[model samples]
Target: MDEKLSKLVQDRVGGAQPVCLFAYDLDRLTEHVRTVVASLPPRCRMFYAMKANSGERLLRALAPLVAGFEVASGGELAKARAVGGQIPVIFGGPAKTPAEIEQALRQDVTRLHAESVLELHRISEVATRLGRIAEVLLRVNLAGPFPTATLAMAGRPTQFGIAEELLPEAVDTARRLPGIRLAGFHLHSLSNNLSAPAHLELLDFYRRTVRQWEREFRLEVEVLNAGGGIGVNYADLDEQFDWAHFARGLPAVVDAFPEHCREIDFECGRYLVADCGRYVVEVLDIKRNHGVDFVLVRGGTHHFRLPVSWQHSHPFTVVPVEDWPSSAPRPELRDAAVTVVGELCTPKDVLAREAPVSRVRAGDVLVFSHAGAYGWEISHHDFLSHPHPEHVYYGDSA
Candidate 1:
């Protein structure tokens, strides 16, 4: 780890000022990433979803391991390219304009995962106009009837993948299109709860589709993007996912297809970087109202931006900074139950409504975990024009 970064992490782990501490335990993160990679049968590729976290240091650390990049926009594509990343890149976004399609085709991205019929047509048009063939995959929607409690893709009104029924037709349409090739299929229906059965079902679905396509359309499938949604432990930090179990299941999916080894890609996002980051905020004023005490902080949803955007509830812990220290007595405060609030000037900017924290006062710092996923980048606005939080990556394994 850089000395500066190590000092910063130490400071947040024990400092006074409110700091958004963000660093994944790289050893643990890599263990998880490698396990996920190892689980796949031969020929399957895993791509890190870049929108999850764009910290340059983290990207540099993760670039060498994952198979490719799964980007949703042109800006993300540019960032990946700027870092001298050579992995195949896949673009996924429904409202892509003509210009974006043209740029993607020009760059010859690994694959463009087109969602809607209109976007598919636009990609074809752009490829035809550019006198090129855009390697593409059709997104499929295999959503379940009800929403799963966690952030699974089953029940959301997801405008992401094409309906399962429409996939075959979409594949046939791609075969007929002038400027596009039916490279394969793309799916992200189950967001972060991918069990072995889910993986098997998805692979089987594709296997049947491939056989049907080969027999009827005479088209061979080149790519099978079993989109990634491996869930991480946000609530319980101790229970590690058995990536070996997941890896054990990959071969079944790969062996079934036989020919397309290494062509299957996993679009993983949160599993790669969420555990690596932390958000630290300072305790401001402390007040007691009714039966509950409130500890105000210097950050908000406008700054951290996770609780509000994704309806997420993060875990909080306190580190002794200056206040009431045995020998480091500096600021102010004692111990009591308190709710944490931010300075966003919005009632909804509440960090925690029921945390049993100490009777905190101005200067004390509180740290929150699982902040690396959609923390600052999600629902940010210039509402109060708060300065963006400083993002530092920890290079050394913790």
Candidate 2:
């Protein structure tokens, strides 16, 4: 366990009481943001993807550091505005209600990504009603030899963006629309991509495609939103994305399209905030099921769903407890392979499965790191009416 995390668990957990806790080290988050921001090339613009972790405390911490926020819905846009007043916001999603479009237009978002021809028409309609010139970006679904990713949105018939073949029609329609000003293209295809070289290659492809489109269509592109897909190494910490190398290599990629003269936007989510948060849950029971050791905690998938989603053992460290007050005989596990499960009734509530731990007993805290992003918000919080975890923010007060 990290020394700071160990101390935090010790300080936060009470004797023999099973409580779920999420502690975020804001100082670490700020430093991570600074490192990423400083490493980027002059042409690269960073935007925090609000969908990953929309916690107000996290948003407040990131407000001053990021170029702006990339939101998917009206609520996220409102949240971004609430935390980062007047800061630029870009909206993108497959489904957008008329009301949402109206709100986005009223809010004067930096750019709105048109996922489909209908969405482009809707934006034009809404903007025309408001008598406002709406800056728009066509989200392109590339046809390829796609990069390897945990989730691939492009290079397939996904309900995400308009296909590359259909982009010409969309662009022509956009040019015809009186209320719409076509800015550029948004090519966000992958999710959780770990390789920096792969990302660089993707950017190079994006630049070439953008330049080709600009030339073929005789259009001026002001921005090329290369959509954020940077991955966090959850399985192995050492094999993390080489950000320093990526930063160093970005200039070459940017310089390749000198004729394009477009601002490259990175709307990163998980990579920015994952390291700064810890999910600390106290073990309620230690048992053996069919010769397999099971360490049951007070919380489960409802509180943190990433492990369940990935179906992999979440990386965690045991915070040993000195005192054990249970009158019942507690099962002892030492250097054992155990599956960490939550209080949920279903078997799918496992957090970490068949992992070797030094020692874990009742009242011991299992601290799961790299949970700052997609930890709380993506969870099914209201399920079974179980008590919620305490969201603790460390560092400066929010």
Candidate 3:
């Protein structure tokens, strides 16, 4: 523990008993999100990827910040709609069931990104049957070396969308289909780092492809959908995301295509809300065994998922209550290197390994920072009958 964190433990948790709790810094988190969004070019729109953390309160707080949402299922779309009316929403993913399509169409969403030819046909048929025209974006495949190794779908040999060579045929099919409108193009390649030149190159490729499509088909693209793999703070907190460079480079690419004045659409999930929330769990038991200290927390992967989802090794600064000793406990206090494990029955439920902290007791609190995005919402389940984690907003109410 550093000097500042040691004082924090003494101040916040000094005399109060420690129990499991989660909190969000809405103002700071939203400020950070605003800073990131501000760096984009004018007329560039961002759709908050809803899979990151769909807590109703969190969604409500973030709704006004972004242009719209990018949802994967009808359930997520419903959640978005529940937050308000006429929220611009788009549904992605492959092979959505008939009910999901109907729900999305009924919600009057902005667009749907079709991942397969069958899905395109299905949307056309359903929209026609319902006396409506569904605007769609055909997701394209960009085969290359992806940026992050942690992305599951990056290098996998799977068919999620149209191949690069087959896109023209698919566009022709869309042109022939009556009830479906080909609104734009979509590409969600697995690249995390937003390298200046490489990112520019990717944008140039899309712009060139869109231009070629316009020349070949004599149709205009309303949106150029460049999908999201923008990495958030996964490894280190000091690493700053280069938003200004991305903003500056993107306009340069779009400026090349003067006739293509379409909106630059971004579907970013993790970058929006990952750092706004923290996970706090109570230490259930503390023991010294085999020359090591073990601090078992009350929650595990069933609730706090990122510590396991990303194979994450970062431990948050644990602070005791205000009155707790800021200095080291008396030498009589058996201080040792502690490993924080969760209460789950499996051995894989470890949270942090070899965490260095003050001598922890059975009821101390452990706060996991940078847990707001893809932490609880994406990978959590009701396994072992544990209750779902609660979410709260801090700006207006708190």
Candidate 4:
């Protein structure tokens, strides 16, 4: 932990109740985003996926830095509008309701990713009813025998995108449908992808596939939505997806791309904000059970679910607290491989398993790194009626 975060842990944790806190350094976030945006090739745009972390403050901080935000639901759209009402937004989701479609059309989003034939029709109907022409990208689930990621959203059997074989029908229908324009195709193939070469290969695949479609259907495509599947490595923080290398390789890909395609949209979620925030919790107790060392903390999957959700032990560092009360015995472990757990009743409430540590004691604080995205946002905060962790935002977007 840095000096400021260390001080924050000291101030927040030590209370009677076990302290669980989420602190965000927005200055760090802003700088990281600026670097990412600057690295992109010309005509390529990044849309921050707000489903990752939609703290109004984060959205406001990112509004100027990013080209736009990509929202998945009407509620997210409303949140985006609330933060940056006039900023451009591309709306996407596998399942969208008619009311949501109507809401999107009324708001005049920049683009919509149609997941199925019926979704295209729904958008057209809604747009026609509202007297608006909707620009759409058909989300394709490519029939790929290609490389995959931790979570494959496409290029396989998934409910995420339109099947490869069903494209012709979808394309014909989109062209025929009133108040709808088939701008291009959306291929968000996978999630948490860690390889830059594989990513470039994927982009090449997209370009080739789009070219083939253009030739076959006699349609001009203005946009090619690669979607966002770039990943962040949690297990080994030192080794990360090489964005610099990936950015350097993009120009060649763009030069080779169809000249008519004007924009390449990367609506990334996890990779953007994962490292900007940290989760801090105080050790409530240390115990030994069934020949296993258990270190229980105030926070659990209820607060940050990324670990159990991915079934990986999240990386953390111990911050020792000096002021242990004299009344109780200080339970401590040395050179221990301990399983960190939370206050939840279920056995599944684990954060780290058999994680080796030099020394940790009851009252010490553990700070989980790279928790900015998909931490609290995806957690079941209401489960077991535990009090929510305090959110502390700093560094300019606060």
Q: Highest TM-score among the candidates is held by which one?
A: 4
User: Cα miss at 105, model 4 (Å)?
Assistant: 1.3
**Each prediction's number of clashing residue pairs:** 11, 0, 11, 0
lDDT of 1 at 318: 75
lDDT of 1 by residue, 241-266 (tens): 55666567757767888474338777
Give the Å shift of residue 125 in candidate 3: 0.9
Error of 4 at 273 (Å): 0.3
**Residue-pair clash count for candidate 1:** 11
User: In angstroms, how far off is 138's CA in candidate 4?
Assistant: 0.1
Q: Considering summed lDDT, which 10 consecutive residues are worst modelled in model 1?
A: 146-155
Model 4 misplaced regions, further than 4 Å: none
lDDT of 4 by residue, 215-306 (tens): 99999899999989999999899999999989999999988987788899899889989998999999989999999999999989999999
Give the lDDT ranking, best first.
Answer: 4, 2, 3, 1
**lDDT of each structure?**
0.69, 0.89, 0.72, 0.91
Candidate 3 lDDT by residue in tens digits, 103-167: 88888988898887778888888898888899999887756554543462433566667876677
Residues 132-229, model 2: lDDT tens digits: 99999999999967689988989987899999999889999999988999989999999999999999999998888888998899988888999999
Overall local distance difference test of candidate 4? 0.91
> After aligning candidate 3 to the native by TM-score, how far in Å is the CA of 205 from where it should be?
3.6
Q: For residue 384, what is the lDDT in candidate 1?
A: 86
What is the full ranking by TM-score, best candidate first? 4, 2, 3, 1
